[model samples]
Target: MIWEIVLFVSILYLINIVLLTIIVFKGPTIGDQVLAIDGITYGSIVLLILFSVYFKEPILTVVAIPLALWVYALDIYVSKYLERGDLGA
Candidate 1:
Protein backbone atom coordinates (compact mmCIF):
# COMPACT_ATOMS: atom_id res chain seq x y z
CA MET A 1 0.00 0.00 0.00
CA ILE A 2 2.72 2.44 1.00
CA TRP A 3 4.78 1.46 -2.01
CA GLU A 4 1.86 2.19 -4.29
CA ILE A 5 1.45 5.63 -2.75
CA VAL A 6 5.11 6.36 -3.30
CA LEU A 7 4.92 5.24 -6.90
CA PHE A 8 1.87 7.40 -7.52
CA VAL A 9 3.51 10.48 -6.03
CA SER A 10 6.70 9.91 -7.99
CA ILE A 11 4.75 9.67 -11.23
CA LEU A 12 2.88 12.86 -10.45
CA TYR A 13 6.12 14.65 -9.68
CA LEU A 14 7.62 13.61 -12.99
CA ILE A 15 4.58 14.93 -14.83
CA ASN A 16 4.85 18.19 -12.94
CA ILE A 17 8.50 18.50 -13.93
CA VAL A 18 7.65 18.20 -17.62
CA LEU A 19 4.80 20.68 -17.39
CA LEU A 20 6.90 23.21 -15.50
CA THR A 21 9.71 22.87 -17.98
CA ILE A 22 7.36 23.79 -20.79
CA ILE A 23 6.02 26.72 -18.80
CA VAL A 24 9.51 27.97 -18.04
CA PHE A 25 10.55 27.94 -21.66
CA LYS A 26 7.26 29.24 -23.04
CA GLY A 27 6.92 32.07 -20.55
CA PRO A 28 6.62 35.40 -22.38
CA THR A 29 8.48 37.63 -19.94
CA ILE A 30 11.30 37.58 -17.41
CA GLY A 31 8.90 37.74 -14.51
CA ASP A 32 6.95 34.82 -15.89
CA GLN A 33 10.12 32.82 -16.27
CA VAL A 34 11.16 33.59 -12.74
CA LEU A 35 7.78 32.46 -11.51
CA ALA A 36 8.17 29.24 -13.42
CA ILE A 37 11.60 28.65 -11.90
CA ASP A 38 10.15 29.25 -8.48
CA GLY A 39 7.45 26.73 -9.20
CA ILE A 40 10.11 24.20 -10.15
CA THR A 41 12.01 24.85 -6.96
CA TYR A 42 8.85 24.24 -4.95
CA GLY A 43 8.26 21.02 -6.83
CA SER A 44 11.80 19.91 -6.13
CA ILE A 45 11.37 20.48 -2.43
CA VAL A 46 8.18 18.44 -2.41
CA LEU A 47 9.94 15.68 -4.34
CA LEU A 48 12.74 15.68 -1.79
CA ILE A 49 10.26 15.15 1.02
CA LEU A 50 8.63 12.34 -0.91
CA PHE A 51 12.01 10.75 -1.47
CA SER A 52 12.89 11.00 2.21
CA VAL A 53 9.73 9.12 3.07
CA TYR A 54 10.37 6.49 0.43
CA PHE A 55 13.86 5.91 1.77
CA LYS A 56 12.84 5.96 5.42
CA GLU A 57 15.61 8.22 6.57
CA PRO A 58 15.28 11.30 8.73
CA ILE A 59 18.60 12.78 7.62
CA LEU A 60 17.54 13.49 4.04
CA THR A 61 14.34 15.11 5.25
CA VAL A 62 16.37 17.83 6.92
CA VAL A 63 16.99 19.52 3.61
CA ALA A 64 13.36 20.01 2.70
CA ILE A 65 12.60 22.82 5.14
CA PRO A 66 15.68 24.85 4.29
CA LEU A 67 15.21 24.40 0.55
CA ALA A 68 11.65 25.63 0.70
CA LEU A 69 12.49 28.62 2.88
CA TRP A 70 15.52 29.59 0.81
CA VAL A 71 13.58 29.54 -2.44
CA TYR A 72 10.80 31.63 -0.96
CA ALA A 73 13.31 34.13 0.40
CA LEU A 74 15.03 34.35 -2.96
CA ASP A 75 11.71 35.00 -4.66
CA ILE A 76 10.98 37.87 -2.29
CA TYR A 77 14.45 39.33 -2.67
CA VAL A 78 14.34 39.19 -6.44
CA SER A 79 10.90 40.78 -6.55
CA LYS A 80 12.14 43.59 -4.33
CA TYR A 81 15.15 44.18 -6.55
CA LEU A 82 13.03 44.17 -9.66
CA GLU A 83 10.58 46.66 -8.21
CA ARG A 84 13.12 49.08 -6.76
CA GLY A 85 16.31 48.28 -8.65
CA ASP A 86 18.13 47.61 -5.37
CA LEU A 87 17.68 45.07 -2.65
CA GLY A 88 18.67 47.36 0.21
CA ALA A 89 21.39 49.72 -0.95
Candidate 2:
Protein backbone atom coordinates (compact mmCIF):
# COMPACT_ATOMS: atom_id res chain seq x y z
CA MET A 1 0.00 0.00 0.00
CA ILE A 2 2.70 2.45 0.89
CA TRP A 3 4.67 1.48 -2.18
CA GLU A 4 1.60 2.06 -4.32
CA ILE A 5 1.23 5.57 -2.88
CA VAL A 6 4.87 6.31 -3.50
CA LEU A 7 4.63 5.15 -7.09
CA PHE A 8 1.57 7.30 -7.64
CA VAL A 9 3.27 10.34 -6.21
CA SER A 10 6.36 9.79 -8.30
CA ILE A 11 4.31 9.48 -11.46
CA LEU A 12 2.50 12.70 -10.68
CA TYR A 13 5.73 14.52 -10.06
CA LEU A 14 7.12 13.29 -13.36
CA ILE A 15 4.11 14.62 -15.22
CA ASN A 16 4.30 17.92 -13.38
CA ILE A 17 7.97 18.28 -14.29
CA VAL A 18 7.30 17.56 -17.99
CA LEU A 19 4.61 20.23 -18.20
CA LEU A 20 6.75 22.75 -16.39
CA THR A 21 9.64 22.07 -18.71
CA ILE A 22 7.44 22.76 -21.70
CA ILE A 23 6.34 26.06 -20.22
CA VAL A 24 9.89 27.03 -19.38
CA PHE A 25 11.01 26.42 -22.94
CA LYS A 26 8.10 27.98 -24.80
CA GLY A 27 6.64 30.59 -22.54
CA PRO A 28 5.75 33.83 -24.35
CA THR A 29 7.20 36.15 -21.73
CA ILE A 30 10.20 36.18 -19.43
CA GLY A 31 7.94 36.36 -16.39
CA ASP A 32 6.18 33.20 -17.52
CA GLN A 33 9.47 31.42 -17.96
CA VAL A 34 10.65 32.49 -14.51
CA LEU A 35 7.35 31.39 -12.97
CA ALA A 36 7.65 28.02 -14.64
CA ILE A 37 11.16 27.60 -13.35
CA ASP A 38 9.99 28.47 -9.87
CA GLY A 39 7.24 25.89 -10.16
CA ILE A 40 9.80 23.30 -11.21
CA THR A 41 11.94 24.15 -8.20
CA TYR A 42 8.96 23.78 -5.88
CA GLY A 43 8.00 20.47 -7.47
CA SER A 44 11.52 19.17 -7.03
CA ILE A 45 11.40 20.11 -3.35
CA VAL A 46 8.20 18.08 -2.91
CA LEU A 47 9.79 15.16 -4.74
CA LEU A 48 12.79 15.35 -2.42
CA ILE A 49 10.54 15.10 0.61
CA LEU A 50 8.60 12.26 -0.97
CA PHE A 51 11.75 10.31 -1.74
CA SER A 52 13.01 10.86 1.80
CA VAL A 53 9.80 9.29 3.11
CA TYR A 54 9.96 6.44 0.62
CA PHE A 55 13.57 5.67 1.47
CA LYS A 56 13.14 6.17 5.22
CA GLU A 57 15.96 8.70 5.21
CA PRO A 58 15.17 11.70 7.37
CA ILE A 59 18.42 13.42 6.46
CA LEU A 60 17.45 13.68 2.81
CA THR A 61 14.46 15.79 3.80
CA VAL A 62 16.68 18.24 5.65
CA VAL A 63 17.95 19.78 2.43
CA ALA A 64 14.54 20.77 1.11
CA ILE A 65 14.19 23.91 3.20
CA PRO A 66 17.56 25.27 2.22
CA LEU A 67 16.92 24.38 -1.42
CA ALA A 68 13.62 26.26 -1.30
CA LEU A 69 15.32 29.28 0.27
CA TRP A 70 17.94 29.28 -2.45
CA VAL A 71 15.35 29.17 -5.20
CA TYR A 72 13.53 32.08 -3.57
CA ALA A 73 16.75 34.05 -3.40
CA LEU A 74 17.35 33.30 -7.07
CA ASP A 75 13.93 34.64 -7.89
CA ILE A 76 14.66 37.83 -5.98
CA TYR A 77 18.01 38.20 -7.69
CA VAL A 78 16.53 37.66 -11.13
CA SER A 79 13.74 40.12 -10.50
CA LYS A 80 16.20 42.71 -9.32
CA TYR A 81 18.43 42.14 -12.31
CA LEU A 82 15.50 42.45 -14.66
CA GLU A 83 14.39 45.65 -13.06
CA ARG A 84 17.75 47.40 -12.73
CA GLY A 85 19.98 45.57 -15.26
CA ASP A 86 22.23 44.51 -12.40
CA LEU A 87 22.01 42.11 -9.48
CA GLY A 88 23.19 44.77 -7.01
CA ALA A 89 20.66 47.22 -5.67
Candidate 3:
Protein backbone atom coordinates (compact mmCIF):
# COMPACT_ATOMS: atom_id res chain seq x y z
CA MET A 1 0.00 0.00 0.00
CA ILE A 2 0.95 3.64 -0.35
CA TRP A 3 1.08 4.00 3.38
CA GLU A 4 3.64 1.26 3.68
CA ILE A 5 5.82 2.82 1.04
CA VAL A 6 5.60 6.18 2.75
CA LEU A 7 6.58 4.69 6.05
CA PHE A 8 9.59 2.97 4.51
CA VAL A 9 10.72 6.16 2.86
CA SER A 10 10.29 8.06 6.08
CA ILE A 11 12.45 5.60 7.93
CA LEU A 12 15.12 5.81 5.27
CA TYR A 13 15.01 9.57 5.37
CA LEU A 14 15.43 9.57 9.13
CA ILE A 15 18.43 7.29 8.89
CA ASN A 16 19.95 9.58 6.30
CA ILE A 17 19.29 12.55 8.56
CA VAL A 18 21.14 10.94 11.43
CA LEU A 19 24.09 10.08 9.18
CA LEU A 20 24.14 13.60 7.77
CA THR A 21 24.05 15.09 11.25
CA ILE A 22 27.17 13.12 12.05
CA ILE A 23 28.73 14.38 8.85
CA VAL A 24 27.93 17.96 9.77
CA PHE A 25 29.67 17.52 13.08
CA LYS A 26 32.69 15.81 11.55
CA GLY A 27 32.97 17.86 8.36
CA PRO A 28 36.55 18.93 7.73
CA THR A 29 35.91 22.30 6.08
CA ILE A 30 33.34 25.06 5.97
CA GLY A 31 32.20 23.99 2.52
CA ASP A 32 31.69 20.46 3.74
CA GLN A 33 29.49 21.73 6.52
CA VAL A 34 27.43 23.78 4.09
CA LEU A 35 27.01 20.82 1.73
CA ALA A 36 25.88 18.63 4.59
CA ILE A 37 23.33 21.20 5.62
CA ASP A 38 22.02 21.30 2.07
CA GLY A 39 21.66 17.54 2.09
CA ILE A 40 19.64 17.72 5.28
CA THR A 41 17.41 20.38 3.78
CA TYR A 42 16.65 18.17 0.80
CA GLY A 43 15.95 15.20 3.03
CA SER A 44 13.52 17.24 5.08
CA ILE A 45 11.64 18.18 1.94
CA VAL A 46 11.24 14.53 1.02
CA LEU A 47 10.03 13.73 4.51
CA LEU A 48 7.49 16.52 4.22
CA ILE A 49 6.13 15.03 1.03
CA LEU A 50 5.77 11.68 2.72
CA PHE A 51 3.79 13.28 5.50
CA SER A 52 1.59 15.06 2.97
CA VAL A 53 0.71 11.77 1.33
CA TYR A 54 0.09 10.03 4.62
CA PHE A 55 -2.25 12.77 5.81
CA LYS A 56 -4.00 13.24 2.44
CA GLU A 57 -3.19 16.92 2.44
CA PRO A 58 -2.47 18.38 -0.98
CA ILE A 59 -1.34 21.75 0.38
CA LEU A 60 1.76 20.32 2.04
CA THR A 61 3.04 19.27 -1.38
CA VAL A 62 2.90 22.89 -2.45
CA VAL A 63 4.65 23.91 0.75
CA ALA A 64 7.49 21.54 0.00
CA ILE A 65 8.15 23.29 -3.31
CA PRO A 66 8.97 26.63 -1.76
CA LEU A 67 11.03 25.07 0.99
CA ALA A 68 13.01 23.16 -1.62
CA LEU A 69 13.63 26.30 -3.63
CA TRP A 70 14.63 28.26 -0.55
CA VAL A 71 17.05 25.63 0.60
CA TYR A 72 18.63 25.44 -2.87
CA ALA A 73 19.00 29.21 -3.03
CA LEU A 74 20.47 29.30 0.44
CA ASP A 75 23.00 26.69 -0.61
CA ILE A 76 23.97 28.79 -3.60
CA TYR A 77 24.29 31.91 -1.50
CA VAL A 78 26.49 30.18 1.05
CA SER A 79 28.68 28.67 -1.63
CA LYS A 80 29.07 32.03 -3.28
CA TYR A 81 29.94 33.66 0.00
CA LEU A 82 32.48 31.00 0.74
CA GLU A 83 34.10 31.41 -2.64
CA ARG A 84 34.13 35.21 -2.65
CA GLY A 85 34.78 35.82 1.04
CA ASP A 86 32.15 38.58 0.85
CA LEU A 87 28.36 38.35 0.61
CA GLY A 88 27.71 41.68 -1.11
CA ALA A 89 30.75 41.82 -3.29
Q: How far is candidate 2 from the true structure (C-alpha RMSD, Å)?
A: 1.3
Candidate number achieving the greatest TM-score relative to the actual structure: 2
lDDT per prediction?
0.84, 0.88, 0.88
- Candidate 2 global CA lDDT score: 0.88
Candidates ranked by lDDT, best first?
Answer: 2, 3, 1
Which regions in candidate 2 have their CA more than 4 angstroms from the true location? none
Model 2, residue 33: C-alpha shift (Å): 1.1
Cα deviation of 87, candidate 2, in Å: 2.4
TM-score for each prediction?
0.86, 0.89, 0.87
The number of residue pairs in model 2 that clash at the backbone is: 0
Candidate 1 lDDT by residue in tens digits, 1-89: 99789868977987887798899899898788778888888788878888888888868988988877887898888899889998886
Q: What is the lDDT of residue 54 in candidate 2?
A: 88
Clashes (candidate 3): 0
Tens-digit lDDT track for model 2 on 1-89? 99789868987997898899999999899889989989998888888888888888888889999878998998998899889997766
At residue 23, candidate 3 shows an lDDT of: 94
What is the C-alpha lDDT profile of model 3 across 2-33, one tens digit per residue?
89999899999999989998999998997888
State candidate 2's TM-score. 0.89
